[model samples]
Target: MTALPQYERLEAPAIWREGPLAQRREVIVVFGDATLMIADGRSARALTHWSLPAMVRRNPGKRPAIYAPSEEEGEEVEIDDPVMIGAIEKVHAVLEARRPHPGRLRGWLGGGAAAAALALAVFWLPGALIAQAARVAPEAKRVEIGQQVLGELTKLTGQPCASRAGTRALTALAERIAGPSAIAVLPEGLKGARLLPGKLVVIGRETVEGPDTPEVAAGEIIAASLGAAQEDPLLRLLRYEGARAAFWLLTTGDLPETALAGYGEEVLANPAPPPADEPLLAAFAAAGVSSTPYAFARDPSGESVLGLIEADPFKGQPAPRPVLEDAQWVALQGICSD
Candidate 1:
């Protein structure tokens, strides 16, 4: 045999009585289907369309009388049934106790949505916009604007060696110089050098192989990374692209391709951001490398590099510790080749 629905039909109690004169009423109640159903004791005054969910408002008060809409403008027939009256009273109690405060609930829901929207506005949107903008740039534009600028570096009188081992050794040395805070900085060509959130370092082949000493490379990375922090790369991108373009990126995950094309080229040709003397001096000291090399690289004119020259914290100190064994350096350089 099939089981009955999880509800009980019962008489409502005389709890609906209120005011001076004795205004008696009868009611019936049913509990099932996720709501309490109410009706007149004789079924003569049933309100077929009253929402049980909406009846929860009467729970906290004295049991209210069962009233039915009438054809006459404002008339309600009284109900009179002991069982029905008792059931209705119980139903009213349950409803009022469980009624959720609309003000509190609305505040909670609105706050959560606002917080999510704010997070999207601040953190998520900018990167998405840049990625979207990046898509707009023609593939050829990267080749022309970006690649052409890096080609100028070929003018430097460096050896044409392509040995991965050399790059590894250089990386080892740079890591040694950078210590824990070192960010991996690669040349523009081989590494897209995307500065991810939280100042992570992205290295490319050129950074590893272009210079012999790790200190020089580490110094350059430090300089450039510091500049990025001070300037806030994300802010710069938003300013360049405008608010509407940035909004597109937050909802979507691509940037106009042209955004990075010419900019990357310009960045390569331009000297890395100059290090602040006090901070750079500390960094150089911690890395155990002389700041002189980095200073000179930035400004060959001694006049401009006076602070690094003057501070020269390593005037008589021993050189920085080695970051890797010669064999490890060799292996690291070959990692890219494999």
Candidate 2:
């Protein structure tokens, strides 16, 4: 077999079964270049080869490690050899790490383009620099930055409102409207809502308490999600930190503590800018939510958010589905209560 880069050749004794009812056979399992080779124990004849990427662990965290080509297929290999199991896991990790990140590639390309255009004019440099930093940033690094921002915001707003029931309700509501993301209700600071990196959505108590229906709160969450998708939160942070900080982030994937110290105050004092009408309406439509509730909530007169009110996605629908159940909505409303 050809030698694979970054992986050592390993062989171990394991029990192999062709199917659920097939009699177990002792086999010599060899980890080969991008494949697992099964050979007859006594004869040393190659039996079969399984693609390493297609291999799946059948029973995880169990005594004997069981594996299959796919979850739906019944053919399995049971290995008690720790060395072989460890090797398989390590190779899987390496492959996953090497997988392409489209966002990271885009960021690099954007940075190169911006640098090339820098001679033309210096005015466009800041926006391009911040965009490149945000684009190139890995998800893990973004999550860390988001956590730091949240911690800073907590200082001004106190810790996120939490009660077992209220948290459960909040989670359910977030999942319904915003997919799998953390929704934090702040007792103070934020006026309406803001989306941070790492899928954190922060909302003020007023957004929840002021609305008669959960749809209003849900709308705010959807709007924030849309805004974040349109404009990267990390890009905003890098811009606030300035060009020097943007360069540091691009090189080291770290932001200075002092750069973010006053960010929470700035975010709190400034109201979240409204998202574009077309995309915001599309977001509400996709989530099967009415924009009218949130529009009127933002402005009782509905004059400022006339576009949202006029183009309400679920406006004429006799009865749109509730954002949350009656009981869950009640719990969500009182999330800030002591």
Candidate 3:
């Protein structure tokens, strides 16, 4: 027996034609587990169900995407809704992936069609593969990659400062912001902070020493985390190495050492773009930290990041809770002294 198709249910408005000469009618398209259900927009009644596996895109790259139940069918549906189009494309891709491979003779006969498919796959496959790799990668592998990247980074920025007391304090701060996340204070080179795989956050010594309060350092950590959430570090690494490298890592669970050699330098030379104010403020609020100090630190005159200041999560409150005690802050400041 065949297994049931698993997919999310989605619905959107669509213009559908029953035949080549038939007039178009506005209908509601509902994407189901294994089929596309067309419903009467007014009566909310089912009109037809198109099997997802048999559906095909009639136009390759045209706006107002169109689809048909089969190539020989005269009926077609034109959907302008991006969400519905994306859902259809996703389901089509999944179905295609599960289809059986063509025979050797068929492959030779369809060489031209195969070439077109290969071209499209080349453009679309790598990102999807990289995303899948990042999602399924084991924690041990993530840690291994993080450690390797950190090691390469040390060559450019020198070893991360290490004092027993400072290390303890940094760990405390990291725990407060993100449980089980680790922070490393480098001697120099990093602008603010950069997150690595395995929940490792790297920071410049200045972030701790330049500010009087731990809130500044905490804010930077929050910012780095927010950036990482937007773009996964592993995905960036895979993209930099290209599809071949990504495929190799996907199959073997290891990245080529050469691919990561200059990554640290690249990160240090190019500062990460600041996260959006809404998300950044949300991050600060979630951590019970203030963004005012970080805003001032970014621009002493407070002209550029005025939004962060005006919308400070802890603004109206009486001096939000301290990130660390006086002694802990002092220890964290001296992290590079060793």
**Per-residue lDDT for 205 in model 3?**
85
User: What stretches of model 1 exceed 4 Å from their correct place?
Assistant: 1-162, 177-214, 257-259, 269-272, 322-338
Estimated TM-score for each candidate: 0.41, 0.60, 0.64
Model 3: which ten-residue window has the lowest total lDDT?
A: 1-10
Q: For residues 186-283, what per-residue lDDT tens digits would candidate 1 score against the true structure?
A: 43343323332234334455544444544444566556565654664444544444434444444444334443444444443444356578887877
For candidate 3, list the clashing residue pairs, or say none: none
Best by TM-score: 3
Backbone clashes under 3 angstroms, per model: 37, 0, 0
* Better lDDT candidate (1, 2): 2
User: lDDT per residue, candidate 3, 32-150, as tens digits?
Assistant: 65678998889979989998778889887786999999989699998886646755676565455445667645555466445545543443344555566777788888878888889
- Give the alpha-carbon lDDT of every model: 0.45, 0.77, 0.78
Better of 2 and 3 by TM-score: 3
Candidate 2 global lDDT: 0.77
Model 2 TM-score?
0.60
- For 1-338, candidate 2 gives per-residue lDDT tens digits of 12234323456788999988999999998877768899999998999999887789977888589988777777888888664786577555545545565767766666654554342123223455566778889988888888888888999999999888889998888878854378999998678888888878899998888788988888888888887766778877776776546656876678755668888887777645788899899988888899999998888898999999888887788335778889898888898994
Off by over 4 Å in 3: 1-124
